[model samples]
Target: MSHPHLHQPRCLAGIVIYRPEFEALRGLVVSLSGDVATVAIYANSPISGEQQQALRKAASPAKLVILRPGLNRGLGAAYNALHQLAQADGNAFLLLLDQDSAPRPGMAGALMATYRRLAERGERPAAIGPQPVDLAGEKMQLPAAARQNGEKPLRASFVISSGSLIHLDAMAAIGGFRTDYFIDAIDIEWCLRAGAAGYSIWVDPTVPMPHRLGQGVIRLPLGLLLTDQPPRRLYTYVRNQLAMLRLQHVPVRHKAKFLLSLPVRLAVHLVHHRFSADCTVALVNGLRDGVLVRLGPPDRALIPFWRQGWRSRATTPRNTAAVPAALRQS
Candidate 1:
């Protein structure tokens, strides 16, 4: 695996993983880059031969290179690792993707257009992402926001890492991702810092990036139907959200609503998932930690095995006492 030097442009759109759905993934890359002249940052598995052959066929016009990490680092680490690789290639735009996600029609182009337009207008709105729609091409229920004018940049309450685009300049200004976060709310925390620093964040509603809502491995066939809520997700959701609530700038109402809504969401998760031991554990963990930490990142060890950086962090007084010993060790 060749590691390119870091001081280059970020024109590459990277797919982060060890295991891959190269056919599905390379298909998206081919569609977006129009050339496989792209790179795969593999923390564990190399791109497979079948996937490779498919990539070769579909990835023509696009360029593809695979970089094998010395070990299986987590998603944030993979991205920080990929960040340099993308810049090394002299590409101007860096797109973040999960193995299962892809950009819809205008997503790639429109987001690029928005970024350029924002920059030309002299805006430094920290980070931006596509308005995510759920699978089956439906829009997720998103909070409504009135369009704001001017350069303070719009403050974003929530941002997803997958399909997220960050300005390299912003990274330079704020320093690279807070790697110490290692697990949850990474994107939200970073955006919060930028918002705090007066950088605006806006979602280009025109870009329709689709996300696979967490219904789980068993119910994936539901294709938006409910089954088991991913246990690990529940864990991170609880712990890290609490951490964010601690941040002073977060809207008081948002925090209060979230706190109040916890039980209802958990009940829904429990009913849908049958409150299996994992779900129950996750429910307990989520509420306990969300309150104490405000739903930010988890102890580095508890990170569920997964992919992508467009995801952890928070501002809270240390509560080494509040963390569950098991999660702390994981």
Candidate 2:
């Protein structure tokens, strides 16, 4: 975690946690200790007594600043909270992580070094991220743009939320993450807006971070895809992606890509999953909401949809569950 070139003093590290395993969270925080000036954990889920004690004990050595707002504010809102904290503390960069990501040695240093090199070469990058080495899936998805950058770091459309070292001023200029997105596609939307504001997004393959996408993935003839997420998440993914389709800032190619790929994905989910009917209903509802520009958290109208899915699963004979643990909503 030692950063030899720690000249730029204001690098803050933060993670957004929901219901997480105590040991895993502790390991992640310990990994960040020597690399960052300050570490903040924004817990958006209710913590059990034992879990809280374990987190406190883990933080004692690292001296973490943990903030729990007493409710699940979703990913983008929690990220916005971190952005405000970074801004107020006058930090130059914010290293964002998911609760599960386990940083390897020099992970932060690699990102920071790449940022400095890119800046020296006259590239104003909005953020730089490390290559994600999935713990469960063991697969990595790099943007096509990654292959063209040669020796330098690859310029990409958007990086994953975790293992991303974001430039604070650039994010401030682009108005930060959109809370309306709530969960899915928040990073993509922010990247699109940043690009529209003339900022680049780069990925340094040399710095690989151990991350997990879903709890696990399924092998299909087409490819390896994430297991069936919860119906509510499926709805959010559809709605947010469609919402992106309406934005001018989002690249047309990305919009077209989504238009083509999302249906195939939906078909796959409907085919292999036990909750096919629920997924279909969720997709339809999502499409309707997306078309109407209904943004923000799922309101009371959507609660029945979730309840219906749960009831249907409960009544089933075998009770096959599709949602993965890592992808479960808190």
For candidate 2, lDDT tens digit of each residue in 119-171? 99999999998877777535377665545645568889899889899989887
Q: Write the per-residue lDDT of candidate 1 for residues 7-31, one digit (tens) a residue.
A: 2333456676646565667657655
TM-score list, all predictions: 0.71, 0.84
**Could you give the C-alpha RMSD of every candidate to the true structure, in order shown?**
9.0, 8.4
Candidate 2 Cα lDDT to native: 0.73
lDDT of each: 0.57, 0.73
- Worst 10-residue lDDT window for candidate 1 reads 321-330
Candidate 1 stretches with Cα past 4 Å from truth are 1-10, 35-37, 42-46, 70-72, 144-155, 180-184, 216-228, 248-253, 287-330
Whole-model alpha-carbon lDDT for candidate 1: 0.57
The alpha-carbon lDDT assigned to residue 117 of candidate 1 equals: 78
